[model samples]
Target: MAGTSEMIDLKSTPHSLVENFNLMKGLLATYGPDELQVLREKAFRNFTEFGIPTTKDEEFKYLSLRALEDGRFAPAYGATIDRFELEQSVLGPIDAINVVFINGEYAPELSSAHALPKGVFIGSLKDGFTVYEEVILEHLGKIANLTGKLGSTNDERFVYLNTAYLTDGAFVYLPKGVSLEQPIHLIYLSKADHGPLVSYPRTLIVLGENSDAKLLESYLGMDGVYFTNAVTEVVMGESAILEHTKFQQEKLESVHIAATSIHQSEDSIYTNNNINFGGHIARNDVNVWLDGEHTETWLNGASVGLGHQAIDNHTRIDHAKPNCNSFEVYKAILGDHALGVFNGKIFVYEDAQKTDAKQTNKAILLSPTATINTKPQLEIFADDVKCTHGATIGQLREDSMFYLQSRGIPKDEARGLLVYAFAAEVLEKVTIASAREVLENALFAKLKESQDMPEKGGE
Candidate 1:
């Protein structure tokens, strides 16, 4: 393996370099013959052609994939963990059916399966892929095509790396007319006794026609600093409704990159909520495609960064058909030299008439050294469409702060109240009241860090 300086050759694409290509090949060599053949024949071509993306690429400009070039991480160890111990360590207080991954290995003992109603299938994709390989082949790798779109770096390499060493992740299937009463929880945890640990977790959720469900995916880490690269693909059938939330709560020393893609059919409703709170460097790519008419989609996110942490979110919502609707709102709170990046793109096709799309991104920098870069883009080809996008970057409203202070509330309390109100827009959308309260309390705990400052010379 080559070091960071020699991994990505500036003059040439990553895959063209002998070391990068060989490393890619060596990574595949560990997998089964069938898996190796599948990746090499199906996805490896994309990596070979484009190499990895650099800062010159507009979409990946903010995210530094260079970390992967460092060759400092190794695949996580597969260890046997007690079911009760794993559950206690990871799930915390979330209320849902649990699917746990320990050290990148699936722990069946820690998972619970309530008899899913008719038209619902929830389990490991690897199991389904092994037992129902034909079904898996139909939808896998359908969204992120191999063709070099954003300067030749598709997620295929990382995804292929995942496939090469994947132990297991959840696979959810909702049949036509089915409704899941309880949310499905998928948790990924890494215990980093071995240095240079890397874990790739993948999930695929398929919702049939007229189906409704909610999914919560969470990530947590142990003492050792590790790397987690995850991918989730969602396919929503006609008139299907899906409320999906992905929460990242790794340790401060961790590095994580995740990609979430949703494909919607006609009249389908898909809502995606992403929350990020930890990681040394974190990046998320969220993409939703409206393939059929009358589709409705919502993209909402909240992220808080402290210390030297960095969070980057790149999202794309494509209006491919007619009469589709989409709304997006993203909020970020940065402090103590943390960095936040928000890049969102909305594309309306030529035939996407009567499309209604709106997007807004707001950021609050609690520290002067904190930074945020926000960009929202719209490409519309239809004339009969309602599209709007706007972004704002600043600190909390001082006037609101002053108003609260004047009402006899202390300045710290006033700031927390105003900041909580600003974030309430997204928090209110939490479907489960219990889940909402948990997240709300977590936000408060984080905000308290800003409030609990020492008085200057006893005030």
Candidate 2:
């Protein structure tokens, strides 16, 4: 454990950040060999140079990190929680294999990975390095390299932080021509009773050529004011098909920042469903690189914020090769004084002829104080590419409420029904039936809570 020095000025440099850096250096011996040590040093330097992003940064212009910085959270290295307590906080059902992590450390007893397929490997990153050393070394930091041009200054800093503090997370590898019958569920739980803490969880998924698999990553906080900085890197081999889903439901007082990067090969299919329901301040970045021809990608996301919560969703899809296709839809529902932000970008390189990309972001404000900022952008250098992006921000339609009310539905029920319908458009796109059911029920409950409050502009 690391302690912050009170004599240090917090204004010039965040004391907590500095303390965590020192803690990481001290724990470097536990990470791995000299090779990983060098990589860690490089990542630390990147974090120091980029620093924390401020309001002036273009990518984070709509959101601020002051709340997180002021918290001065140190890294949670030796934190521990009971297995029963951790199991109770899991998001999905207990049927799937659950790779559980508590306070950034892998808990094998809480995890169930004994029955995986013959060739499929699902385990912790720290263990993966020892068992699949060659593979892990080859692809561990490759995505970070590819993301050099994808993130803002703040994003880069977080990426570096994640790399420097990278300890334990889920790692899955599917061999060529194999299909996983059951989805691999990765569950991350944060429990920080001692003090304000932070945890960095990393995940790596690789699908071999012609392989098929599904993955679910869920983040939950049992209690306390903490921060969870997580990063997931996925590589899809030629003709690989993968369905990925993420659900984030941290404690309301916690700050959650996550980044997911995907690299698609030729003829590969990648689908992602990201759902955020908790956290005082939550930000998610999803980036996909279509590095091969004939790649197909689908992205669907939904965020629900209440009280003083702030949720931001950012996504980017790069059609680097020709004949690639992508579709994205993100929706947000905010109530009380909550704020929501959505930014989606599509980039089609000059060589990506016949590329087709489409993005849509819709936001609903349930209260007068609730705010939303959405930006959808498309940059296409290829003349033959079909790229389109659009954003919509509005309140629940009174007409729709009236129409539903005319059907004998109560006013509150009508509003809840309409809100649920709006959010279901993206939730229904989630292919995992179990995960979708949980999310649908959660959204309905959130909508009902929002409906209990008086209309923002009405009596």
Best by TM-score: 2
lDDT of 1 at 35: 51
Q: In model 1, what lDDT does residue 378 have? A: 80
How many clashes (backbone N, Cα, C below 3 Å) per candidate? Answer: 0, 0
Give the range where candidate 1 is weakest over 10 consecutive residues by summed lDDT.
Answer: 450-459
Tens-place lDDT per residue, model 2, 1-99, is 011121223346656775677766867646765677777788877666666676566667777888766757877856676766764553545457778
Best by lDDT: 2
Clash pairs for candidate 1:
none
Model 1: lDDT of residue 194:
65
